[model samples]
Target: MKSPSRTILIGGTLSAALTAPVVAAAAPATMDVTITIPQLKVAEYHRPYVAIWVEKAGTPPKTVAVWYDDDMQKNEGTKWLRDVRQWWRASGRTMKFPANGISGATRAPGAQKISFSRAQLGATAAGEYTLVIEAAREVGGRELLRIPFSWPAKAGAGGRAAGKTELGAVTIAFR
Candidate 1:
């Protein structure tokens, strides 16, 4: 004796499955930032305190990096963070010192690079934004540069700006 073969029809279920639009997973958002601390010839040269951030119209700024004197006794380094005036007034005053991942020791005069992932950027809306880099040094002039870019950035999309006194070339790229 042999068993009879049975066939089952999924009907609408099968049709719906085939008709549903396929959504590909979105690629993770990533960004690379570079800034230059031009070596200066002056009577007194102090490492510039630097701050990098992004801002959209009508929203608070999001700070990406802050480089300052982190080795001072009694955490005195934090006191001077305000010297980077634009950043201090925009977002720095509300933040605590030594913020993890965002705070680091000042870099040497050259191109300094840092990268950020979606998580590091927090909840960012898809729209226009400006990358702001500000640098201030003791007994030295202050400089600030801004570069405009779009969020959910297109691959290889980037922008650059040059500073005159305290800072040098500043660039930002999305990947």
Candidate 2:
């Protein structure tokens, strides 16, 4: 038993405590994303500059992530990033040319994985979202692909996708 003020305070504290867990549980989950680049013919030996990101149906796509075009010291990868088109305009165009994340080096032909979390992306950061991947090779053809999924940082929320020869196969595991 307690005074009215004490009872209200305790009751309010209890109410908040009970709902705190629910709020945390409602935060969706994290997403695991992977991308694979394929081997091209000898004539197409240039490792592509791949741009990966998330797109929301109603929202115009924004550049949330990027790979390659980070080796532009002497204008090396400066001209090539434009091949990815979408990423070029979204965030690559004005970038410092060569970023260290994945410059010069090209991904080998095979299945490769890249992981991103809610804490690692924006635009399609949460709620309904679609994953988009664009590959642009020096001599090969350019292609785009997408996977639709919700996100919040689930330990195993992921999906797999196969790219044209320019991209072998992509696997995403959110764990």
Please tell me which predicted candidate would have the highest TM-score against the true structure. Answer: 1
User: In model 1, which runs have C-alpha deviations exceeding 4 angstroms?
Assistant: 1-28
lDDT of 1 at 5: 8
Clash totals for all candidate models: 0, 15
Compose the digit string of candidate 1's lDDT tens values, residues 68-132: 99889999999889999999999999998888668888888999987765445542577788888
- The 0-to-1 C-alpha lDDT of every candidate, in the order given, reads 0.77, 0.60
Write the residue-wise lDDT of candidate 2 on 91-138 in tens digits.
Answer: 567666444332334566666555443544453345777777888877
Q: After best superposition, candidate 2 residue 127: deviation in angstroms?
A: 1.3
